[model samples]
Target: MIIIFIASLILFAFLYMVSRNKYDEFIEPLDEKEFKIKKIMPIGFWVMDKINYRYASKYDRNLLNKTAELNGGVYAHYYLRVHWANKITFELMLLMFLLFINGAMGKTDMELIIFSLLVMAVVAYALDKDLENKVSKRRLSMQIDFPDFLNTLTLLINAGMTVSGAWTRIVTDTKKSTPLYSELRNVMLEISNGKSEIGAYEEFAKRCRLPEVTKFVAVITQNLKKGNSELVDILKYQSKECWELRKHAAKRLGEEASSKALFPMMLMFFAVVLVVVTPAIAGLIGSV
Candidate 1:
C-alpha cells in the first residue's frame, strides 16, 4: 500500500509539474462554481490533450454540448473539455486520497484496494451526474420564468414597439437576473454588437434548448425573414402554453421539496418515539 501510494503521489506530482501554468490564462477566468476543482483543471486539460481524448463518441460530445451551450456558444467547446477534465481530475484525486489513507492506517489488503477502485468509479459517475443535474436545474428555472417574459414581450409589442425594440426593453428594464433573462440579455448584446438580429435569436434558442424557446425563435425568425402580420397573436398563444409549462415546473419543484423533507421527517419521528418510550421502559425495568 505504501509503495502504491508513493508511486501514485510521485506520478501526480510529476504530471502537475509538467502541466502547471500551461493554460492559466485560459482557465483563470472560469467560474469557480461551474468549473470546480479549478486548480487541477489545467493538469486535466494537459493530460487530455496529450492523450488526444475528445470524448468517448460523437454522441457523448453532442450530449455534453447540449448542456454546455447554456454557458454560451463560444465557450461550448471549452466547457466540454473542462467537463471531462474535471471528472478525470476528481477521480485521480480520490484515488490518491484513498491510497494515502490505506497506507497510513497500515491496512494493505486486496479488498481495500478493490473497494478504493469502486469508490473512485462511483465518484466519477457522480461528478458526471452533477453536470446533468446542473442543466436540469437551469432548465427548470428558465421554464418557470419564460411565461412572464413572454407576457411582457407581448405587452411591449402591443404598445407600438418593434420586436427588436421590445426585446431590448425587456432585457434592459428587467431587474431579475435569472438564466432566461441572462440569455435574453446576451441576445440583445449580440445584436447590438453587430450580429444579425435573426442570427442572435437563433443562437439564443440553441443555447436555451427548450421547445418553447425554439418555437418562439422560429416565430421571430419567420417574422424577420418574411414579416409576420400575426406575430403578436402567435406570441400570446405561446405565452399561454408557457404558463402551463411553468405550472408543471412549479409542481415538480414542490414534489422534490416534499421528497427531500421526507427523510428528515422520518428521522424526527424516530427520535420522538425513542424520547417518549425510553422513560416508560426504564421505569418498568426498575419496578420489576
Candidate 2:
C-alpha cells in the first residue's frame, strides 16, 4: 500500500511538471515573425489546407483569403489547434486518473468503466449541444436587430457623414443596448488603428456570418469603391426588406405556435367533458 501510494504521488508529480512546461510554452511571447512561423507550421494547418484545397477548389480564393484576413491571418488557426489539443490532453489525463483510481480500488470491471465513459460522452455531447443552441439564438437575435442598426446608419449617412463616420456615430448611439453595438465599436477602433474601412466592414460581416450582413457588405463595398452617391437609398431599401422579412417570420411563428397548442387544448376539453359526464352517469346507475 505504501509503495502504491508513493508510485501514485510520483506519477502526479510527473504530470504536474509536464503540465507546467506546457503552460510555459503556451504562454511564451513570440515576435510577429515567429508568431507567423508558428501559425503556419502546425500539422493541423497542412491538414486543413489540403482539405480546403480539395473541397473548395471551385470557389473564389478571395473568400478563403477574406476569412483568413478576418481571423488575423493563418496564425489564428495555430492558436485554435493548440487550445483544442490542450483541452483534449487535459480530458485524457482526467480519464486516466479515473481509471487509475478504479484500478487502485481493485474495481476491475471493464463494463463499468465502459458505461462510465459512455455516460461522460453523453453528458459532454448534451453540454455542447446546449452551448451551440445558445450561440445560435444569440446570433439570430443579432440578425433580427441588425436592420434597425442599418437604418440608423442610413440616417447618419443621409445627414452628411461618411460611412466610417456613420459607424462611429452608431457605435456611440447604440453601445449600451446590444452586443452588435459593442462589436461595431470595436470595428471602429480597428478602423482608427489603421485598418481600412472595407477591411473593418469585411471583418464585421465575417464575424456576424449572416447572409444579410454579407450582402449588405458586398453592396456597400462596391458602392464605396465606385464613389456611388445613392448609398443611403440602398441602405434604406435593405432596412425595409429586413423589417418585412421579420414580420413574415413572426407571423409564421405565431401560426406554428397556435398549431402546437391545439392538441393540448383538445385534450383538456375532452378531460373536462369526461369529468362532468362521469358524475352524471354514476348517479343514473345508482337511481336504476
Candidate 3:
C-alpha cells in the first residue's frame, strides 16, 4: 500500500512537471521508420508505429480521416496524430499491465480478474473520452469559422466567380488555418480528381455534420441544380444568416457566463454578511 501511494505521488508529480513544461510537445517530428522510443517501458511502444501503420492502412480512407481528426487534427498533421495515438495507446497498455500485476500480486484469482477488467474498462473510457473531446473541438472550431467563411464566399461570388470558382479560390487563397479550411482543401482535391462540384460540396457538408454547414450545402446544391443565376444573392443571404446565428450564439455564451458568475457572487455576498454579523453575535454571547 505504501509503495502504491509513493508511486502514485511520484507519477502525479512527474505528470505535473511534464504538463507545465510541455515536455512531450518539445520532440520534433521524425520519420516513422527512424522513430525510436527510448523510455522506461520497451514492451509495447517501440514497435507501435509499424503496428499502427499496418492497422491504419486497413481502414477505409474516410475512416482514416475521422481517426486522424479524433487523434488530433488541430495540433498535429493527420499522420503525426495517428502516430501519437498509437504511441499513447501502447504506453497506456504497458502501464496498465504493470499496475495490474502489482495489484494482483496478493489477490485471489477472481479478485485479480475483476481488478484487471476494471482497469481496462477505465482506460478504454478515458481513451474514448479524449477522442470525443478532440473531435468536438474540431467541429466547434469549424462552426466558429462559418460566418467568416460565408463572408469570403459571398465576396468571391459577388466579384463574378462561379460558385465552384469561388470555392476553389477561397481554398487556394485563404490564409486562415482552421478545420473548415482543411476540409475545403480536401473538397478541392476531390473536385480536381473529377468529382462533380455538387458531389464535392455534399461530401464536405456530410463530413462537417453541422446544421450551418448542411444549410449552406443545401443552398449550393439547389443553385447548382436550378442554374446559378441567383448564386450571389444566395451567398449574400447565407452570409447574413450565418452572422445572425453568430449573434445568437454569442448571446447564449454571455448568459452562460452570467450564470457561472452567480456562484462566486453568492459566496462573496455570504462572506460580507458573515463579516457584518460576526461582531454583533460576539457581543451578544459576551453579555450572556
Each candidate: how many clashes? 0, 0, 0
Predictions in order: lDDT: 0.87, 0.63, 0.67
Summarize candidate 3's per-residue lDDT along 121-213 as a digit string, tens digits: 676566555556666777767877889878988898888888888888887888777888888888889889999999989878877877889
What residue runs in model 2 are displaced by over 4 Å at the alpha carbon?
1-13, 21-75, 78-86, 93-97, 100-106, 123-138, 244-288
lDDT of 1 by residue, 12-62 (tens): 998888988798876788889767689877778888999998576986676
In terms of TM-score, how similar is model 1 to the real structure? 0.91
Which one is best on lDDT? 1
Query: 1-288 in candidate 2: lDDT tens per residue?
Result: 335445665764555554444344543543444233332223323333435533234332433343333334544444444433333333444555666666676756787678758855765455345435544655656666888888888898899988888877777766465556666776888888999889888988877777778888988888778877777888888899888766766676688789999999999999999999999999999999
Better of 2 and 3 by lDDT: 3
The TM-score of candidate 3 is: 0.56
Clashing pairs in 1: none
Q: How accurate is candidate 3 locally (lDDT)?
A: 0.67
- Candidate 1 local accuracy as lDDT? 0.87
